[model samples]
Target: MSQLQDNFGRRFHYLRMSVTDVCNFKCTYCLPDGYRPDGKPKFLDLNEIEHLVSAFSQVGTQKIRITGGEPSLRKDFTDIIRIVKDNDKINTIATTTNGYRLAKHAQEWYDAGLRRINISVDSLDPKMFYQITGENKFDDVMRGVDAALEAGFERVKINAVLLKGLNDKDLPRFLHWIKNTPIDLRFIELMETGLGHDYFKAHHLAGNDIKLQLEQAGWQFDTPAVDDGPAQNFSHQDYQGRIGLIMPYAKNFCASCNRLRVSAKGKLHLCLFTENGVDLRDLLQTPDQQAELIERLHGQLAQKKETHFLHDGITGVTQHLASIGG
Candidate 1:
């Protein structure tokens, strides 16, 4: 298989496919009361999706992460997994879920060749969790975590999106939960992903501050943890699990950016913050143009944004995270 390398020499090996733009929970950070889907009802059908993945795999993409507004909301979610599972080149099939619908489908998804799972849990406090997510489903997510572990899936990591005063007060609470399990806990810096720039700026907590706070609380910062993505990992002498910080704002990880995202609407997002990309859906719709489509994809990727402009003025694909497939 040919490796899809950009002009910057970064080889593309991972693909983030947003299967559906519909979600159940309306998280304030991602989806809110007024948020709406940007794509058609059936954006990318099963065959179109499989063909795109096949084209990408030929260009050295070994891992595919299925994302969404909430992927489980789609009835064909499991079918998409099964379709990708048949590919010998793609070694991993992962999904980032809110965990509301996971308890019921964890076992089924696991059986359908799902490998990795990252569940989003901001706070342990019921009211605080609801406030952040605008959904009173904390217990359901907890049950989903338990269900993932029980399904014989190991390394079930927890993703906590860190905010200034919203979820920062519960940092110790999150650390305590990490101490109780062997699963990894990751703290993601608030990204200015077109949700509400002002809100993001107000709650943008530097990764260094979070690390310092943990150190002051007696958590020792150890060596980094191993992972596929860009999260900086750490460990504590007293804790069994590991801690990770994804600082896309203060510290940009674009130098090593090797992944590309395809929104549910079928547009290729070369960079999370860049508006440049190709309309793969339209090209694929044309008959007998697979080779043309592949060449066009490479052309778009050759222009992957140098950086997301985290510390600078943010001007790019400023769409909400729900539509962008976080």
Candidate 2:
């Protein structure tokens, strides 16, 4: 069992795999309207995805997060979760979804051994929700959240990407809803990628500012416990659950980053904002090639960039949160 490490000396232990790029909602920050592909790209077959996960597990991957344009959109998502959960080496199995279809699938996913779920919901207002996500089923998403809570998903995360002029006003409302629920509300700073660059000019609302607002609102939070990702978490005083803030653009957590992402096309991305990625799909066809691929992944880790230059001169290639994973 060889261990994989990145260029920054961070050991790889978590892998976020994107199953499909097809999604129903065309969010302004993710995929915009009129963004069309010339042709359908080849998606990894169920067997191939299982093989990749199994091989990665053997090489020291203990956590596997399934992501997508929306993973629930995949027909075999439940079985995919089961495959990772049944693997003895994988201790954590989770998925990130938009929650549009979670009401129907959350229980099935839980039965298949999914331990956690992260749902991307930008706003609670129906109109604002439609404006942000290009969908009008905000009530359905709320029901999905309720369903997840009932389905025994212990960690139900609500990921809200804070766009300065768009959803910034909705933060307090989001925090209020989460105060009574068991879900963990996570505020993500908008990054300069995908459709975000087209609409969002300033990625304002620093983590400290949010914290101050919560404090002034008579909500006190404990110092966040350390975690694998960049989310700085805090449990509100007298609140049942916690609130988290991921400041990727303002405060980069690249130094302690122990995660790696596999894009839908099978490229291993060392950093979210990295323009290049190492392809591993073809190499997984053979056992010998699989071992070599693992070694290469480990070697690539050492070269992981310390942080991303989102505002840099990279035109239209900045890391899109949805394309990579949230």
Candidate 3:
């Protein structure tokens, strides 16, 4: 296996694979209403996906996260999980889901060697939930969360996308839920991506703001006592579970970004905010071209932008989060 170090000397070892570009829910933050496409989405076949993962594994990739328009929507999702977990070099296999189908598949996923799961849940209130997701199935998602816990997934995480004047008022209620539930809660800052910029005025919230809100609500912050992702993890002084804040816009983690993303159509993206990507599907069709493709991939990593300028007036290169596999 080959090791590629960034300018900051952080070894890149994680790969995020978007297995599909189809999702069921239309979250206001990601995909707004009245948004339609003229044509079908480009999806990767199982064999092509497996080949790409195998190639990446040969280059020292150890952690692979299965993301999608909604990864759970994929028919061969279990098979995909099995292939990645079967790889001896892959150390972690995780998935970011909408939790719509989690209840039904949680046990199967656990049996297939999946150890981590992140569920995107924006609001806890039923009416606000419908307003955020444009769907009235809040109870279904809650059921899915309970099902995940019942399935014995050791690490279940809830991801909340915070928007000002929206669900921000429910932060305290969200924290209250976290205190009683065993799963970890994460608060994500709204990025100016997809429909976020057009419909929601990037009412960005920083990590410090979240901490302050918790304190004002009478919740004392005690560090979770564990070092994790870019998220700043904390626990209520007497709560059972933990809370995390992902402040991408305010506090950029590009320097410490240890992961790369691959679109469902087989394009290798070096950053979440960049539009340029290396097409690996074309190279895979030509057996004699794998080595050159590998070299080019390494070069892309070297050229990976230091940070994404979402709020810096740069626009129209990176596709919407749905298309880019957020």
Candidate 4:
């Protein structure tokens, strides 16, 4: 069994696979424009997804993260999970969802071999969630979070994109709320993503200043925010849960980059900030060419841009975040 190693010698262990780009909520960042549910990719079926995951696992991917505009929207999401577990002995089978439908599917997903779950909760207030996400699924998101914990998943992460002037006021509130909960609340920095100019200009928070505020407020973070993963984790003396800062814009996480993403349409994205990618959908029906696809993916990783150009004054692309599993 070979692992995915680039020319730079960075061995990758994880792949985030977006099952579909269509979503219910037209969030300001992810689907800022809009989407058509009928536009979902049917090119790769459950069997094809399983084959893709197995092929990657054979090439050294240990963790496979199922993502979508909302993975739960798929009626066969659990079927995909079951097939993935049966096809490969992946160390972890995880999924990222908007949490609108997680409440109904969390237990089934856990039984189907899903071990970890990441839910997007932009705000604890419904009004704010609606203001940011353009939907009133805040209660649904909370229900999903509670369901995930009750379902006994190994790790339940609450991912909040930190918009500078918009949601920064809720940091202390989130910190206090997580004290006795099991959620790993993480604050993700607003990235200059393909969502376009309006989204890019929304992020004005500096990672250093944010960290300083957290430190002064009495949170103790032991790990460097830029190490291993994007989030620098913090903990309080009494809080059982952990707080995280994913300073993707303020902290360069490229040095420890260990992930590659495949869009719902079957395009392989080597980096989050780049539009350059190769389509793998055309090769799925030709199983004999799995080796060729693997070679193509590995070759591209060698040329993967060391860091995103967001900090270098480069504007992002036009692809939707829901499409890329970002």
Per-model CA lDDT versus the true structure:
0.81, 0.77, 0.77, 0.77
lDDT per residue for candidate 2 within 194-258, as digits (tens), equals: 55655556544566678777777676555632325677777766667778878765555666677
- Per-residue accuracy of model 4 over 140-211 as CA lDDT, tens digit each: 889889999999998899988877767878877887778899778887877665446675676556666678
Alpha-carbon lDDT of model 4: 0.77
RMSD in Å for all candidates: 2.4, 2.3, 2.7, 2.4
Highest lDDT model number: 1
Model 4 CA lDDT for position 205: 65
Q: Write one digit per residue (lDDT tens) for candidate 1, span 156-268.
A: 88999888888888876777787868778989988876557877878878877887776776766555322267777777777888888888865557877778889887889
Native-to-model Cα distance after best TM-score fit, residue 60 in candidate 3, in Å? 2.4
What is the alpha-carbon lDDT for the whole of candidate 1?
Answer: 0.81
Runs in model 4 lying further than 4 Å from the true structure: 36-43, 222-228, 316-318
Model 4 alpha-carbon miss at residue 245, Å = 1.4
> TM-score order of candidates, best first?
1, 4, 2, 3
Q: Give one digit per residue, the lDDT tens place, for model 3 in 95-191.
A: 8998899888899998998888899888999999988888888998888889888888878999998877778899769767877788889898776
Listed in order, each prediction's TM-score against the native is 0.92, 0.91, 0.90, 0.92
Model 2 clashing residue pairs (backbone): 5-298, 6-301, 6-302, 7-301, 7-302, 7-303, 8-302
lDDT of 3 at 8: 62
Worst 10 residues of 1 by lDDT: 219-228
